[model samples]
Structures are given as C-alpha cells and as structure tokens.
Target chain A: MTVGRKLWAIIIIKIFIIFAILRLFFFPDFLNSKSDTDEGKGDYVREQLINRN
Target chain B: MIDQIDLSMVDWARAQFALTAIYHWLFVPLTLGLSFLVAIMETIYVKTGNPEWKKITKFWMILFGINFAIGVATGIILEFQFGTNWSNYSWFVGDIFGAPLAIEGIMAFFLESTFIAIMFFGWNKVSKGFHLTASWLTAIGASLSALWILVANAWMQSPTGMEFNPDTARNEMVDFWEILFSPMAFNKFLHTISNGYVIGSIFVIGISSWFLLKKRHILMAKRSILVAAIFGLITSIFLVGTGDGSAYTVAQSQPMKLAAMEGLYEGEAGAGLVAFGILNPDKKPGDGEDAFLVKVQIPSLLSILGYRNTEAYVPGVEDIVNGGYKPWFEKIPVEEKEMTYSVAQKIEKGKLAISALRDYKTATRAGDSILAKISQKKLQENFNYFGYGYLNNPESVIPNIPLTFYSFHIMVFLGFYFILLFIVMLFFVNRTTLEKKRWLLWISLWTIPLAYIASQAGWVVAEVGRQPWVIQDLLPTVAAVSMIDTNSIRITFWIFAGLFTALLIAEVMIMVRQIKIGPKEGGSK
Candidate 1:
C-alpha cells in the first residue's frame, strides 16, 4: 500500500481501539450507569448536588 | 444523601481533565489551521495549473492528515471524560451545554469527516474543481466544529441564556440564539480560530525554513514562506485584536480573573498594564505585602484595555474579594457604576438561592404549585450568585494567580513576537536572502515549538484563570466531579498520560520521516 493508505489504516485502528474497546471498558458513562431510568439518573445527580456542603 | 466526599477525588479528577485538555490542545490547533493552509495551496495549484504547487499541497496535506488523525484521538477522550469524570457537571448543565456539543457532532464533525475522505482519496478520481471544493469544505467544517465547542466553552466562562430549573435540578437553555450569539462566544471563536491560523502559518514556514537550511526544495521553501508569512502577519495582527476583546470581556464579566491575570492586590483608577513582573509569593488578598517583587508597566494601558477609558477603575484581587469597588457599566467608556456585592454578601445570597431551590423542589414534590412558584421566584432572584453558596470562604474564589498572570503575559509577549518574525521572514524571502540567514532559518525552525507554546499558554490563561468555576457564576468545579473513587481517575490519568505521550512520539517520528521524504516523494498527483 501507499504511505497515505498506511496512515489511514493506523487512524481507523486507533479509533476502534479507543472508542470500541477502551471507552466501553474504562470510560462507561457514570450517570447512565448510576440508574436505569432517566428519573433515577436525575435523582442521583440531584442528590449529589444538594448534599454538597 | 451521600457519604462524606473525598476531597482528594476532586483534585485527581481535575488533574485528569487538565491532562486530557492540555494534550488534546497540542494537536488540535494544527488541524484547525493546516487544513485551511493546505486548501489555499491547492487553490493556487489549480488556478496556476502548476504541478509544483500540487506537490507542495500534497506534501502539506500528508502532514495535516497525520496531525488531524491524532488530534481526533485526543479530542474524543475529552468528551468521554465529561461522562466519566465529570458526570455531575454533565448532568447539571447538560440541557444547555449538550446542545452545542450535539450540534457540533451532528453537523460540523460530520461535514468535516465526509469532506476529509474526498480531500484525501479523491485526488485523481475527481475533477480538480471538485477536489478543491472538498478541500475547502473540509477546512470550513473543521472551523465550524471549533465554533460550536468554543461557544460552549464561552458559555461556561460567561454563563448566559440558561435558567436553573429547581424541578429538574439542572440549568436549562432558555434562549438558543442568546447562547449562540453571546459576545463572549463571538470573541472566543474569532480569537481561537485566528490563533489556529497563526499556528498553521508558523508550522508551514518553520518546516519550509528547514528545507531552505538544508539547501533542498529551495523554490518550494521560498514560495511556502511567502504565503505563510503573509497569512501569519495578517492573522497575528487580528489575534491581538481578539486578545484585547477577550480581556475586555473578562474585565466586564469575570473581575476575579482579570485581577488574577494582572496579580493586582490593590486596584486603582488608571491601573497600568504589567509589561513584565514577578509575583510576590507571600502576597495574599488582604495582606499589606507588595503584590509584585519587581515590575514594569505601561501606564493607563490596563484601564484603556479593560474599560476603554484612561481613568476607569480596575479592581485588584483584594478589592474584588473584600468588595467596595463599584462595577463599571458593561458598555465601553464606562459611563456609570453600580454597587457591587462583596464575596461574603454574594455567599449569603447564594445560600438563599440554594435554600429556595430546595424549597421549590420540595413544594413541587408535595404538589403545592403556589408554594413552588414563590420558592422558584426567590431562587431566581439570588441565582446569579448560586455557585458562591458552595464556598466556605471568600478566599476559595481566588484562582492560582501566579499561573494566570504568567500565562497571560507569555501569550501576549509571544503574540507580538510572531508578528515581528513574520515581517522579517517576508522581507528576507522577498530579497532571496532567507536561506543565507542561517541564524534566521534556525529561529524560524525553532518557532514551530514556540507556536505550540503560545497556543497552549493562551488556553492556560483562559482555563486556569477562571478556576473553581466549571460554569461561570453558577457552579463550582469541586461540585462538578462524579462521585467515583479517586484511584480509578488516577489510574486512568496515568493510562492516558502514558498513551498520549506514546502517540505524540509516534506522530513526531512519522512526521519527521515524511518531511525527510520531501514533496517529490509525497506522490499524490
């Protein structure tokens, strides 16, 4: 392959590694995982906010 | 509602975010400006029907691709961090902040991504005109992406067009147009993009200067320098104007930041601009010690810059924290003043606002609409100082003054230097004496890193200057972090630090290899 295609290949692989593997494993959304429903998430955030001194 | 919070977690989370942001920035400005510079080169190539121009365009495009790819890798992590490390910040201001980010993803990112493919791969397959259009569109799309993100950032710096909703426990967007067209947003977008343009020009000229020093691609180096120097000169001048606009906005909206940027302890009418200074390490807001150890200042410049009047009052850190100084009118030339609350008074108002919000929430839960309305009204009245409620002391409001002051001065100093460098470069190139000026060539080559330093320093001034506020006046950063364990953030920070450093090394290696290969071997056309 040409050098251009090689660079493109690296980019695609990097994205897949970062988003699909690393993000899913290491960086799950905190609020989303805190509760199953929107109301629960809202309650979680509200509790965190109000309880801060 | 929750257990005793770990203060260490908050500090670690901040460190993680700062790490990601600073690293992300290293690559982003290059992509912002280089895309446009490459497009400009391509336009010249097509118009002139010159193969040499095509070679130059293709060569630069390769480097742009390298920087753009790595930049995206770092950028995506920053967004994810909001959900991971700063979930509370995300949830609190999600309704308002998410709009710009979502639009950035849906519109600008998509536009740039689509055109970038054509820009890279459709060279021989597409007509020259179509390819050129794609190139231009890619550049435009990158800038549009910057626009939305910077607008969101500006809103954080100067929160507007949002209302705190007690029922939802979040700040919600009330006026989309107001958020989009805020004066802070406008200046931020212009300043940031001009900064990008300047970085791009510097990068181009810097690399071209290397070629001239080596006595290879002599013609190409001269042509590239000519274009880049002209572009750099114009954008550098524009960057100065935007910087001034930024200072004025900061003075009007974030006086604490302005005070910190100057390290001013005791404010006065017609405060001079600090041309250079060393901060007194022992100085505190109310302390009688000198704020600066040694200093040189341009008389009345700070007043003129901040308030557009020679004699307009500029507040010091002490004045802002202890409060007796009147707030100048937002309109330039400062015709009138209004009474301003001290930090202590604002904290009281903030507590009232917070209490009212709680009451409003409770009333809503109890289905008492009348009580809820009254509580909401009270909350609204004091909501302007809501973030201050979380602070235990007025001293917590002071950001790291030394960092902000130094970063601002460094950025300003480098900005003027860039204009001078460009003028000298243009003159030498025109006279065909640039290659002979070995010292100048070395200076030009070294400027690539200085451009990066200047760009990063600008962000340091902006982000570090407005410390303790994730969303200006509304939210404290300590309250913004997710309630996750500190160890997790610490681990991730190390992981990211190691990973990003590796990526940066690989990028530099690849870029160096490409630069060595030279334009003849770039082989696009």
Candidate 2:
C-alpha cells in the first residue's frame, strides 16, 4: 500500500476506537439507580416509631 | 450495639458495590491501556512507514470494541443502582456524589462521545488530523471519567469539601474545586488511572505474546509487544508511585482502614509491616500470646507510612475497635436517634396513610362502609411501628472474612509486585535489552492476570473494608437498601448476572476470534 493509504488506514482506525470509547463512557446517570427512591416509600414507619416514643 | 439491621445494610450495600465495581473494572483498564496502545501504534505507523502498524491498531481496535460494549452495558447498571438500592444514601449524599458525576457527563462524556462518532464512522470521510484528535480525545475522556468517579469515591472515604445540612438531612458541596482537588481525590484518581493503564498494557502484552508464541503475524506481534512493554513499564512505575500516595492518604484519612489493611492489632510505635500473617483478631497483639500466627514484619514500614517517622504511633485494629467507637451504634446520641426514627416512621406512616386514604375513597365511591372500614383497619395496622424494632435489629448480618482479608492482601501484594516489575522493566528497556529477552515477554503476558486480580482486590477492599457503612460512619448498608423482597433481589441479581454473563462471554469470544485471525488480516479488512 502507498504511504498515504496506510496513513489513511491508521487515521480511520484511531477514529473508530475513539468513537467507541466515547459512546461507552459518556453515559449519563451511569451509576444512579431507580430503586433508591423506595426508601422514601416507608415514611409512615418512622412516624409511628416517633409517636410511640 | 450495632444491630443486624445496621450490619445487613452494610452487607447489602457492599455486595452491590462489589458486583458493580468488579464488572466496571473489567472494562476500565482495557480502555486506559488500549487507548495508549492505539496512540502508539498510530505514532509508529507515522514514524516507521509500516502498514503492519496500521494492521496491529485495527486488530486491537476490534477487541477494544467488544470490551467497550460490555463495559458500557455493565457500567450503566451501577448508576441506576445508586437510586434503586441506596435511595436514602442518594437522598443524603447525592448532593455531594452527583457533582462529580455531572462533571463527568459534561466535561468528559460529551468530548469523548462527540469525537468518538467522528473517529469511528468518519474514517473515509474525516481528515487524518481530525481522526487523530478523536483518538486522543477518547483517551482524555476515559481518563476524565476515572477522575470524576475517583473524586466521588475518595470524597466518600474522606468526605472533604462538604458540610452536613440539617434541613436536607444530607451532605452538600461547599466548594466544587475543593472536592475535585482534595488530597485523597487526587491520590486515588492517580492510583486508579495508573492501575487502569497497567491493566490495558498487560492485556495487549499478554495477547501479543500468545500470537508470537504461535508464530502468527510475527512482525505485527513483535511490534505490538514492544509497544505494550514500553507502555506497561511507564504505567507500572507510576502505578506504584500513586499507590504509595494512596496508602499515605488512607493512613491519614482512615487510620482504621490502614490498620485493617495491615492486620495490626495494637497501638505500637515503630510497628512492623506484616508481609503475611494469619490475623487472629480474637487475641490481643503483644499480650505475649502471639495473635499474629507466623508474623513476618518489615521493621519501621508501618510507622514511616503512617506518620512519616519510624517511631510514630500507629493505631491498630484493637485500638480502633476498642477506643471510643467500639460499638459504632452507641456513638449516636438520642436526638440523632430520635430524628432517624421519626423520619423512618414518617415515611412508613405516610405510605400507609396514602394507601388507606386511597382504599377508603374507593370504598366510599362504591357505597360500601364495610370495605372502607376494612381498608381503614389495614391502614391502622400498617401505621403501627411494631416493625421498627425489626428495622433496628436486622437478621442475617455476617462478615465474609476470608474473602475480605484475602482480597485486601491480593490488592496490596499486586501493588508492591507491579512496582518492582515496572522498575525492572524500565531498567531493561532503557538499557536497550528489552527485545532480546523472551522472559520479559512471558512476564508481561502474566502481568495481564495480575492487573485484573489487582483491580478486583482493590474493589473488594474498598467495598468490604467499609462493612456496615454505606455512608461511612453514618448510614449502615442494610438500612440503605430498597424494602423489596429477597425474591426480588435474587431475581434481579440472577437476571443481571445472566445478561452480564452473556455479554462477557460474547466479548471473550469476539476477542479470541480476532486474535486467532491475526492482525495482518485484520488490517486489510
């Protein structure tokens, strides 16, 4: 292959790798969970404990 | 007494953290080390005018693709679990944790993603310079992601740049820059990223060595090994340095963790660093009973690491466990106890009230006082705080000691080994004798497993060492979990496990197939 074509290939490969990484790492809300809100579901339990005391 | 509820919360949170951390790491190291390898490959192609270099880059890129996909898939669940499993923790510390995550999204994610698309699909369309820029951007993005995640994690360990807000019942950021640049954050970030680089390099080296052994793609394999070795040497050296810095930070910020890591049991000046010991926590150290069975001590190491002096006092596990904070539960005053109890009760009562009100409204609309009364009685029953006692004293809270202790040691041992290995590799490569040695090739290959083991160990130590604390000294892990049934946790766990397993298997299969085909064919494709 010619020098330019080899250069083009190298450039293309690098771009592909970069794009793949970006898509993988750029995820928003990556570590946040939906079930976390369930703790808020049982406020009555706490209120009852306090009232009893 | 720290009851079962507290301990179970810790166990649950820890299990979740461990599962996510182990899976996340399986992806991250590859990202770090592979990016640098690709960069080097491109550089070689530019410098040496070798099309084979281009071929090598293409081959690795394919493996990177598979790993990247699995990494992304496994990684997304961890974020969601923050809300799902640890909702109270999210409410309490999300103000602090969310900042870095936001920054990670804005600063690293966008830059990485934008350029990555151009890089991946724009091969024939985009300019050479633009594509190279994209490659560097992806590396920057990966490193940046590590930075933000470490910043958040370090803050959890040391809790800097944030103050408690009584109104929100949470810790909020006072200064974003302070949290970002905190000593622990910086040290941990450097240590983690360097480890990632080591993992990436070792992965390349190991696979390349396998290719060389098979006499497949001889020139391509040799060049890949040489590149991997160089990257590995540099990264491994830095990994050790950053690890020392991390140890120092841990000593200062969490003396208890340091004590646990070393398996020390007494307050001692000029303490020896234990190389290996069966830690009998049951017996007191230096009671002349010899609690450390077959103790091997490197004199003055612990003292130097902890206090910057060989004679400074380093508190041991016994000191930490016995001194003031013995039963962590007893430390909470009545007011804080009342507040927590009240909040939990309010949440429970509110849920019941809402459900009862709904049932009553439905019964009244249907003109049925009997049904309404039944719903009212059920609501009243649910409103009772009889279950609160159970919440305070949970069942099924046991420490998995063997796993915890071994994981901690594996991480520490790997840290030291990588330091020595990297230093030796650097010396050999600098002396221009790197290529002539077949053993270095083998060592580099073996280092792949070490990289993975080290990552796993670090995570195990982080999650397991913080047993009983989801928010470190504040919230227990069990209390942080969703009130979902055990069957729910089991089902979700299995489903996640199954899906992740499938993805992982597919990833390995793709990588193996690519390696088998060799880079020469890969490049032409």
**lDDT by residue (tens digit), candidate 2, B1-525:** 224233444444456556656766787788877876786787676567667776787787766655664565356567766655555566657468987888888888788667656655565687766777777788878789778888888887777676643223356789888988888888889888888887887787678767655656666666766677678778777876777777677776666567767766566878878777686656543364555666677999877766667766677655554443211122454245321233244335545543564565567669898988887676556543222222332211112344556677788788777656655655654444555666876876688778798888887666566554555444445445544344444445554565556556666765676678666543534
Report how far residue B188 has shifted in candidate 1, in Å.
Answer: 0.6
Local distance difference test, candidate 1: 0.87
Off by over 4 Å in 2: A1-53, B1-13, B281-289, B324-405, B419-443, B521-525
Candidate 2 at B328: error in angstroms? 22
Across A1-53, the per-residue lDDT of candidate 1 in tens digits comes to: 55666677767877886888769988999988889877788888776776774
lDDT (C-alpha) at residue B64 in model 1: 94
Clashing pairs in 1: none
Top lDDT: which candidate number? 1
Compose the digit string of candidate 1's lDDT tens values, residues B249-321: 9998898899889998788999999999999998877769888899999999999899888888998888888
Candidate 1 chain A lDDT trough over 10 residues, lowest sum: A1-10
